[model samples]
Target: MLLGTPAAPADAAESSLFRGTRQFPETALWNDSADPAELVRSIGFGAVGATCNPVIAYTAISKHLDEWAPRIARIAAENPTWGESQIGWRAVEELSIQAAKLLEPAFQASGGRNGRLSVQTDPRLHRDADALVEQAVRFSLLAENIIVKIPATAVGIRAIEEATYRGVSINVTVSFTVPQAVQAAEAIERGLDRRAADGLPEREFGSVVTIMGGRLDDWLKQVASTQRLLIEPGYLDWAGVAALKRAYAIFQERGYRARVLSAAFRNGLQWSELLGGDLVVSPPFDWQLRINENELPVVRRIDVPVDERIIAELSKISDFCRAYEPDGMTVEEFDDFGATRATLRQFLDADAQLDALVRDILIPAP
Candidate 1:
């Protein structure tokens, strides 16, 4: 049966693209939601895990604080000396803890492979290695299956290495290129080596390098017109896919321990190209609903080469070129790349927004 072809009634269960994708060792859904009900719904749809970020946490508390009132009240009561930011951080972590509990069964069943929930440390700490490590340690203590999400910045990479040394599972986010992905994986390996040297057991680390695909395409589209780059109708949105394909190739070549997570997908095509790869696709909840309703032919393109002409054209733009090269850029270059910088800035903005919301919650003016 072709990937996009509809399955017959008798074969529906067996031929479901989502279900079939899950059968692959690499394919698992990390539902990107902080709402418990949404998370439970994702679980019902066979999501193996979930992820929470500052934006999601802010939305949850701003819109559903009543649902989490008891937990928030407990946290507030326990730390009377704490301020709004502290309370906000705890509130976000609490949401993740609750979601992690829902996923704990899968974690046990998968032997640490699935059933994990990720909680991102403060984005403001992205450049502070020591702070990131301290926060990550505390977050890991919340649950055995909880994965600490760290930004894939130079300092964040250092934090990831240290966290790995401490046996904390990490999910490195905002990785948009092959160089960033390679660096993140190398950092994890160094941490594992350090752990082994210290006589610590080489525990099975559950980590992921998240490559933001849709955002890359969005960024490229904005610059394509200015650069006068010839982007074919078919290739306009393929930059992210091409970048991901290259990153996946390097991951396999080096046998990196962390899985590559294809995130921020714009459409079903992106999902189709990346199916059956040794990676996780953390599609938004809405995308999951769309995938369930549509008949999608499964297409695996990890092995397929990105068009040489397109690569050559993109190479004219240094930033785009750098993204496609594995380890071609230094740590500083990777951190300062236009897309990387913009993503980090956006994350900090989200954190600030969350901080404002927390202030309203804790220090409401009369």
Candidate 2:
């Protein structure tokens, strides 16, 4: 298999030699009701997933607001046991289902390895652990290759446990810190263990740690300009080598089922530039396009062969998202409407324990 080959056709299987770039346009997957299959086919992306939040949902649903009025009215007439929330869920459900359907053939061809749709669980349920589990179960029923997008919240961990028990595949989304990542690995093992004990099928489960490349760099730059930017001096958890080293060591240790999914990837000495990576999830539209055209120029696999000393340093830091729970919080007490950014902010400010973990336990494995 040559390194450079023409992009595979829509109905074709993902190329063995070429790793597919997953694209999230920093916006909606489709606009003005763009045809899902046609758009996916045209993009040449081997797999594409939709990450919806309050904003994206509104953006996608807004286009059909007037158009859906008739549909809404019909639904209202047929089943009065509904509100705007129900309508919205149904609409998103249909869209997600259709998108999954479009990729159904490819998913089958790959034996569920690729060609799938990742629909995010409600952001409103980010903290409600039980709600997340319920949501995962519900969404799982909607599609076979569905990857229930769960936030890396404490509650999300519980959701992962429950959902995995129910035989649903989950993507631990928004994993920024090491402890959060370690906990994700722990949760995955626990889930896998439970599945094994229950005599459930051992499906290919994955725990991906999302290292926000540019976001972390940007945040670091912002913090570096501050006074207590003192998280520096001692160990290296924030920068290029330090971060990648931490990722590699853990992925190689405690969690074989857990893989490092380089996310929110920035351009610097990140994966493509200096540090060679085994796998990366692509989001930048322009770069992926350039990559497709062979226009990016230098796309070498960056493998930073670090020595044991570097490994020891990374083993020290504990985790990311100090405000979040190590095991994650249960999302049962909160309602969907009550889950807000302000609450997330509060948890973050309060979770000083986790911050210490990142600085202590989660840096790297010695």
Cα-based TM-score, every candidate: 0.90, 0.64
RMSD of each: 3.7, 11.9
Alpha-carbon lDDT, every model = 0.78, 0.49
Instruction: Give the Cα-based TM-score of candidate 1 against the true structure.
Output: 0.90
- Residue-level lDDT tens digits of model 1 in 120-165: 9898887789999999999999999999899888898889999999
Candidate 1: worst 10 consecutive residues by lDDT? 2-11
lDDT of 2 by residue, 1-366 (tens): 222234445335332113323322211111111236333543354433333333334444445555544554565566666654565556567667776776666557646644446666766566588888888889878878776767666677777777777777766665554445566667777888898998988766433444444444444444444524434342333343345446556666654465555554455334344223443353443333334444332344334454556444433332222212233233322222122233344333423322332223223356
Task: Judge candidate 2 at residue 241 and give its lDDT.
Answer: 37
Could you tally the backbone clashes for each prediction?
A: 4, 25
